[model samples]
Target chain A: MNHRIGWLIAGLVLALAGASQFLLNDYYQRVLSVIAINIILAVSLNLTNGISGDFSLGHAAFMAIGAYTSAVLTLPVRMKAIVLPDLPVWLGQLEVPFVFALVLGALLAALIAALVGTPVLRLRGHYLSVATLGLMVIVQVVALNWQPVTRGARGINGLPPFTTPLWAYGAMLLTVGIIWRVVHSPLGRAMIAVREDELGAACRGVRVFRTRLAAFIIGAAFASIAGGLWAHLITAITPASFSFLLTFNVVAMVVIGGMGSISGSVAGAVLLTLLPELLRRVETSLALGGQPLYGLSQVVIALLMLGVMIFRPGGLFGREELPAVLARFQRRRSAQRQAPHPSPSS
Target chain B: MFTPTYLAQQLINALNLGSLYALVAIGLTMVYGILRLINFAHGDMMTLGAYLALAGISALVLPAWAALVLPMLVIALVGVLIERLAYRPLRGAPEVAMLITSLAVSSLIQNGATMLLTAQPRPLRVPSALTQRIAFGDLSIAVMDLGIIALAAVLMVALGVFVKRTTIGIAMRACSENLRAAQLMGVDVNRVIVVAFAISAGLAGAAGVLWSSKFGLVDPFMGFVPGLKAFVAAVIGGIGSIPGAMLGGYLLGFAEVFFVAFAPPELSGYRDAFVFALLLIVLLVRPAGLLGRGEVNRA
Candidate 1:
């Protein structure tokens, strides 16, 4: 839990990621990258949706902005000219290093979040949710109709796959670290207070609006980074790739892991990412009336989520981190060992 | 460009569209009013209705009228079943948990449909009589459109009478106003909830059939967009108010039709975006909607 231990664990993770590049096969490496990106997305989304309780449904839009920005910026100039002929000359000609493009994309996403969050963060409950969903649809509409810049529905492809396990895992660590810091800071406590009771938080001198806006902007920035990583990992980008389904998947991760828990997000990201992959094999082998059982994984996952909601609505961790849970288990066990066994009462 | 005949034709189109939206939105508002839960699966219910109607006509060889009736009944039951199985247990849980559960239900239904039906678009065969057009001097309208409008109006009027005049309807209104007070007054909360879901799903079923007929296609995911738009309509009218939902639906339908009709052709693709923007604007200016009472946050 100390700073030194945190740095050591981060170093170990990066070293493992570096080792995976050499040890793991291409397919496994790709999966690892996807898992890392999903972790970044889930953790960032949890900052707003879970920790701050803002419940944004437009995370995908920010991701799309990041993806598109990074894709356009890093697309070889020749390819940009061919794919996006009508792009502004400055935009069409410019190409940046992968990290710089990703950063720029994140910044752009953060700027848009600030712009949209100003008015939108004023609303509460379902109204806020629908307003955010509207923002998502508007963003998608632009991406779809702005053919010159986005290449219409065809999307962009054949980009260099700059997202390795190292890059993805490193970014994931950074996102988790930043969010972890934010959640533990005074501002994070303010966010929690606002979430519990906006009026009460205001009465307690917490700047409710600023706290929420901060969470929203920071979450959007990290989501954009995840988007950029996703685009580069796949070496292809499409507007459709950043649709509600992606948001739903991320939301599922946050919910299943435990809302308001950082380690829960990591666990949820890993479990959900691997679940479908494992189910994909099951689906292929299963058949009904000689037809392959496609979409089975989705049905199962949805059912699992429903079951979780019904049985354990707090999710797997229920607002507790992995270490906290383990530590509690250890304490309980020690206490049990010290207690005298009771004989049957008369 | 603004000729009377063209305007009349557009008005008819708007009316037809508005009726469908109102039908869907009414159901959504009814559920939200009583439960305060945004049933994300409502749209999928519409899809299921369409598919059921398709099956009734094509697979069962039922007449078109029979097809519509059967689906409505079946979907009504399905709605009640879902309320009991999925929603009842989470009664006192957090709003977000219920929301997530609805999302899960929606995904389950959509994926289940996809798994069983193969996700392909199926054509819903309509009798030729409904497709025939009637002309009034300069303007012409399809019989199906007329039928849809009349059917929707009758259903709404029936619903109004049921809610205002009937004991159960009054019970529903009581529950929506204050569920705890209604229960304290000896209202059968379960019965009222079941009736609300049945009515909502039945309306959605009818709307689904009409919507699919209008578009001439049925698919697993077809209901999502219309369902979402209907929710917007419900919001615009002021959620939890029936008449408000109807009004909002008509307004949305008219806005959409006119926006496309008047805007440049290149701007047509952004019609959905325009609708959502209108939603955002409405939420900002009148969060309680045109008819909804302002929500008071009780400490």
Candidate 2:
């Protein structure tokens, strides 16, 4: 709740991530890293979609930009020439450190978001959603068709696996911290005001468009970083990997976690990420007759999403942080204890 | 390549594609007109229709006409059931909730189909008579293409008459204009919604059959691309206007077919990109679309 405790928790998470390098198996470590990356994505998307009330279905497009950019940058120069001969001469000769490549990728994604958001943010509701979806498809088409730079669907592969649990968790922490700071800032209030009522926010001098553009750009940057981490972790990159399905998964996380709730995003990311793995195990071990339930996880997740939307549309945590929820629970428990037998009728 | 015959052949191709898009887009516009919901699962409905037709023909050994009719009827029922189960509960909820619910429904249908029927593409066989070519000088056209165009035209006219002359159709028009006022005027909102879903799903089913027949394949995910294009068409024609959807569909079909036919061979792969880019341009220039009246923020 306080800065001290927040710093302490952040440090503890990093420590666990470090310990996982030695203590956990490669598979578990990879899963942990993926969880961190998903947290980054879900939380960043929350900034635009939840806090700002802009429903963008193009988060994966930003992620794709980041992944492709970082993958192109961090490949060994010799490998780059072999895999991407059509890349510009300077790009083919250049290779950057993983962190720099990640930052550069994020920057590029943010820049594009700023450009696209200017025209797109004008649309409202489903129109905005469809416009973003269009952006996503356009990105995919370019990635698939740009043979010289993107290898024309072959995708640049055999990249250095630069993503580790440490880097992923660190980026995850940074993303959450930045979003938290934004949510508590004046700019954050302006975003919420704009989301609640655009006309009223304008009347109150919120600069509605600027506030939304800011969130859009910020969300895009983090999504790009998440993409960079994902590409490096997978050690392969393809346009197909960044399809609308990925966006759907992230949206599922944000929705199940609670829109506008940072901690909720984190919780949702962990649950949904692990749910598939758990389901995969269940699917393999348990089957109807002789058939394995290959796509059972997707069915269950979709059903869960539907159930959540119908029953608890606010998601698991609603708009409150974990600490606030726990505090509320504590207060309720003590009050119940104090009034155990006070009165039945009153 | 730029000869009149070549141009005429391309025009026929455009008409074929446009008819398919218009059929799908009409369903989308009709649903949007009444409920203001985008119905993301409509595409999956097409997928289901295609699959159902496949089952009817291949498994049930039904005649071609019977196969087509059965799927339309089944999908219409499925559409009504989906509305009752998934959408009806979230009626007064925020628009986003319904949108997300539709996405969930889409996922359910897609994955459910994948689980039941393998993800592999299945061949959909059309009757030989339908696939036969009808030659007009150098411009040869498939009988299937003619059938699609004719069927689409007939359906559109039938739908036009239904909407204009039928009591339920009038009620639908009233509901689209003002759902609350229609309800206040003693119109059955539930029946109107159900009818909208049924008609949309039935048309989507027909489009799905034509799509599978023309392409000679049926797959669980086959409807996604066409469905998305049809959605773009719906937006272009004004989301809630049936005639607007039809015009948008034809324009998009021409744009796509022409862009692919005329663009450099190297740029042909960017056809989907071109379509989406057009969508962005349209949204920026005319957010309400060509036939759309006023701003789109009804909520």
Candidate 3:
């Protein structure tokens, strides 16, 4: 690893980023917060997609899982009390706070993943993709009909407000940090090996199912945290909000940032999140003739996804990072600063 | 709790829904078997087929036969065009790329329709001749629904004969079984794929008319749900199998309608839920789907 100075620099960059969110207005801050959540989603998705090479479109399904789980758990017993009038006074005032809800949301999503991923993971290619997609549709269908739990499609609104820019970015950083550790771990290496070639990976003694399952559940867990954060930040929840479009957006971000690169995921998330608002602003300032209109953001997103897929399947950064990347930089710096270190030592 | 009339009504609904699913799924299964890609834009193809049918019908009320025939022709051509323009170029690319491209094409079609044909929903015209209902005892079925069932059956038969007995059909089957082997045998693989798309589009075109007439409304986005279900049907039946696609569609339709009919009203909204839950269970139990051949178990 690089010396503490590189770590210090990374920390400083994140700190400066955190402090700037406070400077922005509340709405802008909230948008930035959403970006942070997407960062978690895109990066977590990369764990399965970029590194493991699975087109798991049902990722937003996990987001829905997280959101609904957190919504049920995090919404004050008081809010539920007034909404239901079921005579449980202690439950109404008993808010479980934001962080706890996020953890529960991640756990719920992971639990569902374990259940769904087991058999479905046996299928591969578009079969696996479609099956996972079916998993999502099933979850949505359950959420829509399980009125006692999810409030059906009328949606579960009025979640506690806990996702500020600081909290969201903080969660974002923690998610990225943890995922980075996971990816650098031995398990992450095996997952990548399977992705490169399943037959070869199996021959080399990798447990294909376990590796795939770990990636699947972990991705679900982080996605749920993002969902929890999103639920609270918006303070309003609906199945419609976490529809296929959300999935498309997150996939787009991961692709744009570079599939396997954590840095790329963050870049993609921030760019895509800020892009709609920026485009909406630009669309307002400019116009086709004089009529006020919107939703071209979808057009841009669709085009970008198509363009990226067609032009650059390897994504922006092309998957090479973290294996002596820090050491390479340190070697260069030490050579410059000390001026006596042997270049051959590397 | 089952009455003759109620059973009859559900059967008629199932037939109507099943035929539409058949139309959409046949094409899907053909491509899945041959190319091994799920054209996510397939739903949009159905939408495009309906719109084209609507456009043809809009100019002047043609006789029912002419209306159905001409629209199918137009949509079949459109399907071939899509293959040439989009699917062919991305032929050897990863399935994910093709999937995303299909999505792009889908958004392009929907929004393009919104821009060109007016964003508002339009009523699709059903010929008065075909709109009448035939009654048997207390049970009644619309002519359009009956016609759709009959037509789908005929097409399915015709398709089976064409694919099995004819030279092109045999070639298509050969290509689907082994692309490399068929290529070595001098089959024009590209031509076969285009034909597959054309057939798919034609089926969708026919289904489009029935779909619109039954629903009494037409919009650019109409294909989304049906397309999805047809894909589901394809998966259920077994991707790449013609009979599987049709059978899957009927099973799903019956399952959905039955759930809606029997389940509690609050749970009625779960018709799709039950359908998908059934799909997941199917995935767990029979990962190749009910009739699909299993391959690549460890991805």
Candidate 4:
């Protein structure tokens, strides 16, 4: 099929999935929205982590920034007066539409990313990882302590649930489509080259630092966007919501789905999100030594991640997308059918 | 009050915290020095060691000293197992994969602990000698604090000697210097790696006991903040330098304590924020750390 046709089918599928929310119970619908948000997170992270080859543990920090920005921006002025009596006069009086707040929040996160990336993008490997982890902790501490802005961990409440299934799924589709296009673009190829071999990419006249910085900034922006969606979906925002655990979950999705592939990230996000709920149900039903299992889902997630890392380091999809996987399967089937007789080894 | 006695007390507290940080940082640095992967689970191993000790005291009804030593051994074994099972196969994989795996293993252990024993922070009952205060001139100090400091000093010295004298320790140093050259010299690379993990985890286990004893509590997720601080210490000291890790740990301990001690009362809550900001400053200014050789081309 042509690229246009392929994209049309994917778009149709996403629309149907969004529409199917009406068929689901409230709990399932909520779960679906969460899945969509998670997809945004995983795909955005993949830009820096999988494609650009940076190991960051601070994606959630950016999410926190976005969530707070969106929350503070959209919260009713009267409500803000009660919760954040100390907020700046300008910020206190202002209340924008959710879309504008989301965009501004995302922009603020991207701006922070650019500033942070300028200095932080230089460190490599574990150093970069720790630095980003430090960044995340700093953001968390700020959110917990910055009473004037974030209400010192009481968090903003009574947020309107603007993240309906349509909005969430729509954002997810947009993120995936854009990122997919970027990955196939020249700049994305440059990023992949850097991921493959930074020194070689630099030798070939690819601006290693610039490419990485761009990826980091773009990734951070999208993560912030996801964070905004999440804030609206939950109708509340807290610093705790964007902790390292969330970052870890996103990392798990990227790694398990095949880090560099958009489709793989989507699969990982969906599977990981659904797996916990399924396990939560199982936990109540199953008993170990006459005691109900608690935190079984978390243990299982960790073990699954470890298993994936050890056994399938490239992830389930590796570098292949969904279309590629399907095409490969079809080729194998066709090859078998064309053969007069299948070889024993085959 | 910034009186002399108060300052002295803060100094002692800093040193006490620094001792544990040093131990944890050294372990973290050793692993990073050899494998170049930050074992995010190192902190969790510390948690496991503390939990084991807790389990021994309560369930197995072991004596305090016995409880302390047993957990270290168990954690060391666990560390070796982790090296062989989780990390070994990923030797040739990208660094990012290794990092994620470490995180997975960390969460796996922490979540398992939570499942077994819920997230409630349990107060530990220690032998009175460890917690008893001893008067020293104008300063009154816990025997546990002094003991921890002395123990850390002794361990550091012993580690220095071992790395300088023992064949295996030397092999570890050599491997950290150049893995391929060490292999060419007939150094058993895998054995060195395993021993690195074992020794590191053992130190982390010891630090875990010291930390929990100092704090008087144990929980599933206790290792995270301390682990991050230890990483900060490691980074500040020079990631690959053993002495650097120790120095960084003490510096961090002092900085953290003193920042709280001296900073405006309203800003005490931002102490962690300041600590991270310090890390960022250090990374930007001196990426090689205080005594580290030079910044590697991590890209």
Candidate 5:
């Protein structure tokens, strides 16, 4: 229950995650890396979509921006010549270190988010969502057409693979810590208040617009880092990678976990990432009516998600988080111990 | 820089495309007007209709007329079933919950189709006579295009008359106006909502068959882009206004065709970008749309 002990446990979990990569085969290692990146993506999105109630569908657009930024920065000079021959001399000659490139990528994403959020955050609910989706379509179309900067539809390939389990999980922990601190802060409470009742929050003197914008920027920054990690891990970047499907997957993670719960996002991310891989195996091994059910994995996922939405719409943990659940259990036990005794005759 | 004949051809293309967008936008706006939920599954319903037609014709060897009518009827029921199963439970849920549920339903239908029928696009088989080309000076048009335009206009008029003159249609309009009041005033609320969804889906089904036959392809994810574009059309016209949806759809069609036709060859790929930019501009400048009053109806 002590803060130090909690920090120790968190550090230990990160260490274990890092150590497991050594034990895993190449495929499992890749999967673990993906799981960590996805968790980061899910949690960051939860800050805006879950905590602030913004309902943005453009998370992948920011990811795409981040991935492309990091990729362009870290790409080798010679490869840049081949891929983007019309690249500016300054950009073509300059190659930043991977760490700085990742930071720059995230910063750029946050900057864009700030600009977008200023106008977009004013809209409510479905309008905001549609605007964000429009932004995504704009981003994708730009990436598809901006040949000099993005290599257009050809995409960028042959980048260095700098993403490891340690980097991925370490970045995820940093994201989780930042989000946890923000949501628990006074500002975070304001954001949640806005989510609960925007008009009421404004009436109570909460700077509603500012709080929503903060969550959006923070979520965008972390999503950008996840995107950077994903790009580096895959050693290639494409406009196609950051499509609506990516947005859907992250949204699924948020919904399947309690939307506003950080721990729930982690659980949802990890479980959902592993599920499809498991399903793929099952699909290949199992045959029905003498036919190999090739795409059953996605079908099952969609159906299962629907079932969860129908039956457990609040998600597995709902808004009560891991620590909160434990605290409630302790409180209940104490109350039971202090209660007046019942009649023995009864 | 534009030739008269080329301009005329592009205009024809725009009208053809606009008709499809109008059908989709009407469906989207109707459901959104009543339910106040953006039915993301509308596009998937269109895809389902197309696929059903494909099955009826190719697999069951049904007549072409049978293929078209059967799919529209079936998908209308499917739309009602979707409303009953996926949406009815979330009637009072938060906007996000319903939005996400519609998204889930969309993906479920899309992925289920992919699983049952491979993702490979199959060519649709409309009669050659329908697709036959008719020349007008330097501008040639497919009979299919003319048929689609005529069909779309007739359907729109029919829908307008139905909404204005029929008793059930009056109930739907009342429900959309004020749901609780309509319920209190003896409207069969559930039936009205179900009827709205069925009508919307039926229109979407008709659009789907026409779209597939015109394009000569049927695929699971085919509806996704068109669906988003239809949403754009709906938004631009005004979210809940039928006439606004049609106007927006036509504007979008003209914008898309002209942008591609006139822009430099290299910039042609940015056509969608132009559309989205128009959307953002419209959202910022006139959130109510060109035809909409400033009021945005909320559930």
Candidate 6:
């Protein structure tokens, strides 16, 4: 009936879902973990694209930073001591627990945000997009070339696979809750005001630059956590995985899931991630041959984008908050039923 | 290999790459000047143009000379169709919508290429006249590379004259400055924008052909790098300024070659990253770009 009740319901559903994940086979459980990881990424990115009203292509840079940092920190020191005996135990034996590693990763990513945001925050539109995109490219390039640190283009393999469905989904819920709270907070409202019209917001005493930076840092931190989970889940990391195409996929999810809606972000992350997997299965079953069904995924994504842009420019749930959109619509339908038009005395 | 001849070869390499970027950036500036949209799909359109040209070469075995002329015509028409469909609907929407729409269109085209033709890279064969190289003292050069620079230069001058000396170009310029006032004076804003995309795309197609010719490979993803480089060039040159894009393209080309020459091999993949960093620096120093006009808010 109210926000409290709605949130309670969402929490219950998530808890039940997390419990059920343990019952799943490794393959199906991994899929759930993937979905959870994407949920964090999609929702965090939305804070910038949807709320801060900035389109950042460089999120992968933050994701990479988090993933690599966590992988390096969480790996066993005794193992590295044997392999590279000269290196310090601190660098090698990151024997911290998984959650601590995630937080450390997020902190390091946020520090990077503070450093880069100075120059990057100045740009708007294409300039900003290009700069952020450049950041991503630069990160990938560094990851590939920074051989001593990143193991070069061969990628940093042997990451601990601690990313169970429980951890992944729990992090998603926690991260989403934090972001959703921020989105409705005073700071979030200020960010929205700035987005609606920077000049007007400035006139009204909004610190546009500061608010934007705050949003950027927070979003980066959350994305970092997601990236850490992803690195652990796969047990390997590659620069190629964080390419522009990957950024585009995240952006498409945000756009498709109704950019401004938290529920839409979850829906989008789940649906698009599953859609391709489903399609691949079907194609496999049908024994489709030739080029491995090249570009089918992109085509589906493109068509869906076209349809959403043309027919539902506001996205599936529009700019409306999810709880508001779904709950309000349901309430209206129920109200209509209860008040069903006066039947003539029968 | 590290002799004068080697230096000359690298210079030529840079020039060829830079020339294609300049041509595409020049087209980008025209559309940006006329309508502030960055035309994200411009690069993908170049990919489509290359594909179209490949079809031409495969079907009729057009001489390289004929291809240089023919692909431009076909791509110009395709460009006009893109304007009519995707851009026309969003003329009055926010800049973000148009930008996003261009991205959508680009994805559609890229995937459509995959669906229509195999996603595999193909070698487009050209006539013998185009591939022939001439000896220039210590350095030899591909005729196609020289042709690309020459054609791009000629088109630049032609475009400059069109924007400055022609009534339609003047109308287009006027509309870009103040759409409402230009409409009051009877400028067909829609037609001018459509024309801008068409001409911009035509130049992009010609550049695409040269790009494919020089690289010896063409694929769906080929457009991504060049498109981004040209966008960098546009930003470097000043997004809304034609001469600015040309200058930026040359500088970018020269910079990439020299950066590769000086930097360690491992850092070479960062050529674009270097340009992007410059873009960031340039934006910080001059947000409007080197050639761009000061921000003028619409009344």
- In order of listing, the candidates' clash counts read 0, 0, 3, 0, 0, 2
TM-score of chain A of each: 0.95, 0.96, 0.86, 0.94, 0.91, 0.90
Model 5, A48-111: lDDT tens digits are 8789987878789989988999999999898888887899999999899988998998899899
Give me the candidate number with maximum TM-score.
2
**Candidate 4 error regions (>4 Å):** A10-14, A289-291, A340-346
lDDT of 2 by residue, A1-346 (tens): 5999999999999999999999999999999999999999999999987999988888889999999999988899889877888889988999999899889999999998887787678766566677677778889889999888888688878989888999999999999999999999999999999888998998988888789989999999999999999999999888888877788889999999999899999999999999999889887777666667667888898999999988998999999999899999997777778888645542
Q: What is the TM-score (0 to 1) of candidate 2?
A: 0.97
Give the per-residue lDDT of model 3 (tens digit) for A1-346: 4547546755775786578666778887777788888899999998987877777777778888888777777776757865535424564456676778778888888898888788777677655566666677777778776666667678877677878777877787788878888888999999899888888998999988889889989999999998888888888887777766687788888888887888788778889998888888765666556643344676677777667767786566557554355667787887878656556654
**Candidate 6 positional error at B274, Å:** 1.1
List all candidate RMSDs to the true structure. Answer: 2.2, 1.7, 4.2, 2.0, 2.6, 3.4
Better of 2 and 5 by lDDT: 2
What is the lDDT for B34 in model 3? 87
DockQ-based ranking, best first? 4, 2, 1, 5, 3, 6
Point out the higher-scoring one by DockQ: 2 or 6.
2
Q: Candidate 5 falls in which docking quality class?
A: medium
Give the CA lDDT, 0 to 100, for residue B235 in model 1.
Answer: 87
Q: For candidate 2, what's the TM-score of chain A, rounded to 2 decimals?
A: 0.96
List the candidate 2 regions with Cα displacement exceeding 4 Å: A285-291, A341-346, B297-299
**Residue A244 of candidate 3: its Cα lDDT?**
65
Interface RMSD of each: 2.7, 2.5, 2.7, 1.9, 3.2, 3.7
lDDT tens readout by residue for model 1, B1-299: 88999998889889999999999999999998888888788888889999998888788898888988888999999999999989999988878777788878888888898888888899987988889999999788999999999999999999999999999999999999989999999999999999999999999989998999888999988887788889899989989999999999999999999898989999999999999888877766776788987672322
Error of 5 at B56 (Å): 2.9
Residues A1-346 of candidate 1: C-alpha lDDT, one tens digit per residue: 5789889999999999999999999999999999999999999999988988888777899889989888889999988877788999999889899999889989998898887777667766655566666778788888999988888788888887999999999999999999999999999999999888889998999888789999999999999999999999998877778776788788899999999999999999999999999999877788777767788988887888888888998889988887799999987777667765633431
lDDT of 4 at B175: 90
Best by DockQ: 4
Clashing pairs in 1: none
Clash list (residue pairs), candidate 5: none
DockQ of 4: 0.69
Q: TM-scores of the models, in the given order?
A: 0.97, 0.97, 0.90, 0.96, 0.95, 0.92
C-alpha lDDT (0 to 100) for residue A143 of candidate 6: 82
